[model samples]
Target: MTFTDILREENDDVFQKIFSHPFVQGIGKGDVPKEALAHYIKADYEYLNAFMHIYGAAISKSGSREDIQYFNNQIDFVLNSEIHPHNNFCKHIGASYEELQGYPLPPTADHYVKHMMYHAHMGGLGEITGALLPCPWTYLEIGKELVKLYKPTVNHPFYHWITFYANEQVEETTLQMRKRLDDLASKASEKELEQMKIAFRKSCQLELAFWEMAYTCEEWPVRDYVKV
Candidate 1:
């Protein structure tokens, strides 16, 4: 099977566990803790900023003009739609852009962001896609859990909020990424393909770490500011 196939297969178990977690269930039922909700939103905003910065660099490095254009278009859409709208959402959640920007991120957040940049810099599109798979893919998997766990009267704003990310948005992004990866793999050299495999594994492992950190409320250097 191709690397994409392998990734989908490997992620199956992780996705199930994420959706089943009590925290995720709370989201489905619309009953998340206020603090947890705030943290999730803030962290996601910060991470998106970091992601776009790194993706911009990756697009610059793409060898093919077509790939470069694609990356640029994707980045543009994210900024105009995702990031901009998220900022507005934060306001609705009683948060300000300044506050979200000032809040500290966990160490895992930094590690995850850096990993994406590294892959983009060294691995081209296939490697970059491999590295990125964990983000949306993880959300998509966890979303399934939400669907299973959802309740009608939970009254949890955060639950619905998370659903937006993990379910609809994440699924859309994953499908687009899968297409991109297929395109890249078909054209990539054998060496590049091998690198993509390694990147995929590493990214998956990082994803596991990302969830563990989030679930356990682990604090790192960045956590100094954003206590869980």
Candidate 2:
């Protein structure tokens, strides 16, 4: 099996949790609360920013033009292509995308971003791919399953969001990343492979946590400090 297959098999339990998360299910049903979805769109907008930064880190560490191009293409896709769904959400909910971009990362998103950033800054290309692959990969899987489960129509509130992640373009992008990760794994040292395993697993766990966070509208439990 390819390295990504191994990673998916190892992390299947977490993937299942992410699939079954109420927040995700709500999207499938076209019934998630507008407030919850507004929170999610805002949080995800921030998450995509961090995701692009990791791609930048990957580009910096790339040893070949092809690798740099791959990362660059992904960065462009996230920056331009992914925003439409979020913009649609904002319009429906009357939320300002400008203000949404200004919101702070909630605790789970903060931790997840830091986790990927640490690997991006400190690890080799293989490890960076491992850390970053889960986001798009899982989203593709979730979107595909949601479409099958709900058979969403154009009238569905989240049809754009659901179909965006479920489409051929996303599937193609995910396949490219998986092939890239597998190629890197083939050349990696045993220690690097282990690091990749840990990064992949941790990312899957955090993916699940992100769903839970959105479902609950997660916020900091206590103020970091009181006003002077």
Candidate 3:
């Protein structure tokens, strides 16, 4: 089996929890609250912005012209398609870019972005790929399953989000990343492989936390939330 397959097998339990999480299930059912979704969209925009930074790091770390082009193309896609559309969606739902920009990063979001940036900046190309692959990969996988489970209604608040992930372009991005990762795995030592697995697993866990945070509208604890 490829390293991607192995990693999936090893982390199956984590993915299961993520798939079963009420936040994700709500997407399939269209039962998630608008307030919860607004929180999620704001937070997800942060995640994608961090992803663009990671792509820049990947572009620098790539050894080959093809690899550099791959990251560059992904950078374009995220900026033009993923992030802009997201910002528009947020606006459509009453969350302006200015408002979202001013919002403090929740603890869950802060941790996830730091983990991704740390690996992209500090690790090799392989490690960077391992760290960043889960975002596109997870969404594509989840999107496909949701498509099968339910045909999205035209007015479904999450239809745009659903279709974006389920579309071929996102899956193509994941495939390219997986190809690069498998090539790296071929030359990696067992210890290095273990480290990749750890990074991959941590990303999956963070994704679950991200969804849970949105589902619960979790906010950073401060004087506002704490009893004096």
Computed on alpha carbons, the lDDT of every model, listed in order, comes to 0.66, 0.90, 0.81
Q: State which candidate has the highest lDDT.
A: 2
* Descending-TM-score candidate ranking: 2, 3, 1
Which is better, 2 or 3, measured by lDDT? 2
Residues 22-103, candidate 3, lDDT per residue (tens digit)? 9788888877777887888778777777888988998888889998898999889887888644663575566775566535
lDDT score for candidate 3 against the true structure: 0.81
lDDT of 1 at 69: 78
Off by over 4 Å in 3: 84-92, 96-98, 223-228
**Counted clashes in each candidate structure:** 3, 0, 0
lDDT score for residue 49 of model 2: 92
TM-score of each: 0.76, 0.95, 0.90
Q: Alpha-carbon error at 150 in model 2, in Å?
A: 0.6
- Candidate 2 structure quality by residue, lDDT tens digits, 69-99: 9999999999989987887688778877887
lDDT of 3 at 79: 74
Candidate 1 local lDDT, 37-139, one digit each (tens): 4566566667778777766776776788877776776677566656543553465567775676655567777777887878888767788877776766776
